[model samples]
Target: SAMFRDYLSRFSLNPKQKFKTLSRGMKMKLGLAAALSHDAKLLLLDEPTSGLDPVMRDEILDILRDYITAENKTVFFSTHITTDLERIADYIVYIFKGRIIYSGLKDELLEKYCIIRGGEDDLLKIDRNILIGCRKHYGGFEAMIDIESIGGLPSGVVTEKVTLDDIMIFMNRKGENSCF
Candidate 1:
């Protein structure tokens, strides 16, 4: 009872306020408080920050960080917002079209993929099967590729580090039949 009351106060939730009257952010905070009150070893949160303002989102993230650090807990957070994942996740699992595209350490995933950009002629020289996703513009094409798959890149092609958002977009674009 004390723990629940403490959490409610910590989240600034009014004990007298009816649930139906609470805003989305307030509701999320209440949920967070309830989850923490149980002293659970694991937390599965889906889009906890969705529709929350920046300040509130930041506060939630900080609370999550504190939760894990204080108790050696594990949090499985799923979200479309890659920036949130980048901020707090040490491991990542990417799912696309009911398929698990990747499951590994966040750093390893970042290391394994890259964005490649080059003229259309240069792009044509590369095998389509190796490309994760490709977008063609008026003069050039940009594609996501596994770093290991690149052997000797054509002269005009440039490679850049891939972000979490880039990986999601490209992999989703590839769909079911594509390979990475």
Candidate 2:
């Protein structure tokens, strides 16, 4: 919080002389708000939201939407902004060491993986091949599955909806420490 306080202080806002300051709707606001909205058609952002407040994050998203959806520009931002990604990213390409690992649409990513949870005995009953990655809990095992082979999962293991973040974590873990 202090870091944010320090950052905000850099702006030096004066409550008294409000007229001296530019309006929020001014072009400077648009530019500073969307630094990526320059002549470059493609934007390559890295950790753009790592230190932003929630309100600022939303504001940045607004700026991005204005550029991408309204202005018809292309963005190539790399972020852990899963919430933002769900709303904006049309395609995601997982990269490591300049190599591409997976590239596809966001919706397809959610559809491909699922979380299966059950007791160890219940897990033993299910086909091992269905499991992609697993984490042992106090009472049960939570597993990520690429359930393409079977028509449906086993009775003991219930399939739960997986988010994009879940799939990304599963893929990263499955790919060892090298996935990007």
The most accurate candidate by TM-score is 1
lDDT value, candidate 1, whole model: 0.87
Clashes of each: 0, 0
Error of 2 at 117 (Å): 1.4
**Candidate 1 lDDT for residue 107:** 90
Estimate, for each residue in 27-96, the C-alpha lDDT of model 2 and write its tens digit. 2233333454244677777666556767767766776776688667887888777888887788888674
lDDT tens digits by residue: candidate 1, 46-124? 8999999999899999889889898899999889888888888899999888989889999999999999989978986
Q: Assess every candidate by TM-score.
A: 0.87, 0.71
Alpha carbon lDDT of residue 176, candidate 1? Answer: 41
The lDDT, on a scale of 0 to 1, for candidate 2 is 0.64
TM-score of 2: 0.71
Off by over 4 Å in 2: 1-39, 96-99, 150-152, 175-180
